[model samples]
Target: MSQHFVLIHGAWHGGWCWDGVIRELENAGHTAVAPTLPGNNPDDDLASVTFADYLDAIAAVLEQQQEPVILVGHSSAGFLLQAVAPRAAKKIAHLVFHNAFILPNGASQLDMFLPEVAQILIDAAMTVATPHGSIASPHKNVPILEDLIRNALMKDDSTEVQNALLSRLVPQPFVLFNTKVNTNDFLALNIPRTVLFCKDDRSLPPGTFLKMAQSLGTYELIECPGGHETLFIAPKIIADALTKITINPTFHAIG
Candidate 1:
């Protein structure tokens, strides 16, 4: 059966990152849309972006959809699913976390990252601050280093691919990571969900993704082979896995 997918990209990435996966999905006769959230847009004023803008952008996309979609969140977008799901519950048929973060209520994405890593992000945000601390300061965005991307996020891909991806990535809004998210209503939803993990991803400590996946109560577990940016490096693989998880009911399950 054909399905509709709404792909949400993670920090420093815009909707463009899902181009490959969307192509594969469409070729397989499914429909998909990847919306670049508010602060992620290259032309947007980073300092003006807020966490609410992210939620509002996502909600707007759901409002336009004619039918419920298989909502897929990647990396940092995992928590986005938790924050936006309850309010847009009726618009989502399923929730898929693709090597993403899952934060508990009152916790922020910064709380999930390793201390050193989180500190690096915090430092980056500080470095961009204006001497006068202007409201439009780029300090609101946390810059990502090329080494981190090549060594951790897309380690499985070729140097050419890594460089290409790095060129397009924007600085992620700092507020998105530091802001606490409320998941109380999300936890109450009875949505069918899937944790689509990439076996070779070493972006975080081993088993971190799986541990976060388990927080969903009961969920389908779909594993593939690739790094954190597998959806970009090996789009067809991710497209197939996402298709299978949404169309097939018997995938491995966890509680």
Candidate 2:
């Protein structure tokens, strides 16, 4: 059966981030769409972006598709998917969390991170002032924080990929990370869910993601060998997993 896949990227990344994975999925005869959330690119206004803005982008893409989509979200996008699932429940055939954060109802991305990690993010965001006159972390342009960011997020990725990613990354709105998401509606829908935990992910830490996946009640957990950015590091593995889920609604743990 043919399936449509919508890939949502995480913080600091744009639609281009999924180019590699999109091509792989297309080669396998599946349709994939990677949309850039507003304010994440150079032409976009970083100041005006909000969590709702990101959700709307995903929802709009889902609305145009006639067939159910296997919605995949990575990194910070995990929270976006949870919010989007309830609104586009019927259009979503399955929800795949790729080394992404999975927040419970009324919980924020900060809620998923360790207290120390969360504080680091908060402190970083406090340093910059946005167009809205709010102090937030200007993550995209900060060179001094590269080591910290790389250590926390892309430690498993090749140096080339990590460098390329850092150059193109943009500042994410702090509010997006802090906003609490109501995932109860999504949980109640009983959507087929799978969490792809990249074993080498340095961003969220493997142990933290494992614990979160376990708490999701009904979810298939798959582990891959790579860092937080598997799309670039291991597109073949990620693509294969997507194909498996499309072929069988049942979630199976994979390497």
Candidate 3:
């Protein structure tokens, strides 16, 4: 059966980032929609963006769909999954977290990242001081970001492909990572969930991610070959795996 897939991107990326996965999913005759979050928009005021803006954007996307969608969150969007699911629990068919971060209540994404690791992005970013916090320097830190993404986030693509991706990367707002969400009702939501783990992805340290996925109470485990950027590098694999889960969400052990 054909399914509707809503792919949510992580920081420094927009709906553009899901092109590959969308193509593969579409090829399988499944409809897919990926909404670019407020802060991630090229013309958006990064400093003014907030966590609520993201939730609103996601909710709007869910509203556009007539049928339940197989919701997929990537990277930093794992945090998005925790909050978004509870709000749109009835609209989502399944929660597919692809190499995403899963944070506890009151803890921001910064808490999940290794200080040194988070520092790399922090030190590289140039944010302007605001009443709330700060906004990042758009493309001003691309040189450092290039090295970071290559060595950390994505490792399976060619230098040329990575460069292309770097060109599209935006300097994400601090608010997106600094804000924390309440997952009290999220855990209680009865939606089926799954984690798409990339065995070779060092973007999130090994052993740590499985522990994060396990925190979801009960979730099916799906493993595949590739790194944190597995969705881009291996779209067919991801699309196929998502198809399987959306069709039959069976309980399994963490990969």
> Pairing residues by index, what is the TM-score of model 1?
0.93
TM-score of each: 0.93, 0.87, 0.88
| Model 3 weakest 10-residue run by lDDT | 137-146
lDDT of 2 at 115: 93
Best by TM-score: 1
* Candidate 3, residue 152: lDDT: 77
Residue 152's lDDT within candidate 1 is 86
- Backbone collision count in every prediction? 0, 2, 0
lDDT, model 1, position 32:
98
After best superposition, candidate 1 residue 73: deviation in angstroms?
Answer: 0.2
- In TM-score terms, candidate 3 sits at 0.88
Among these predictions, the greatest lDDT belongs to: 1
Residues 203-236 of candidate 1 have per-residue lDDT tens digits of: 9999998887777987988888888988887899
* Candidate achieving higher lDDT, 2 or 3: 3
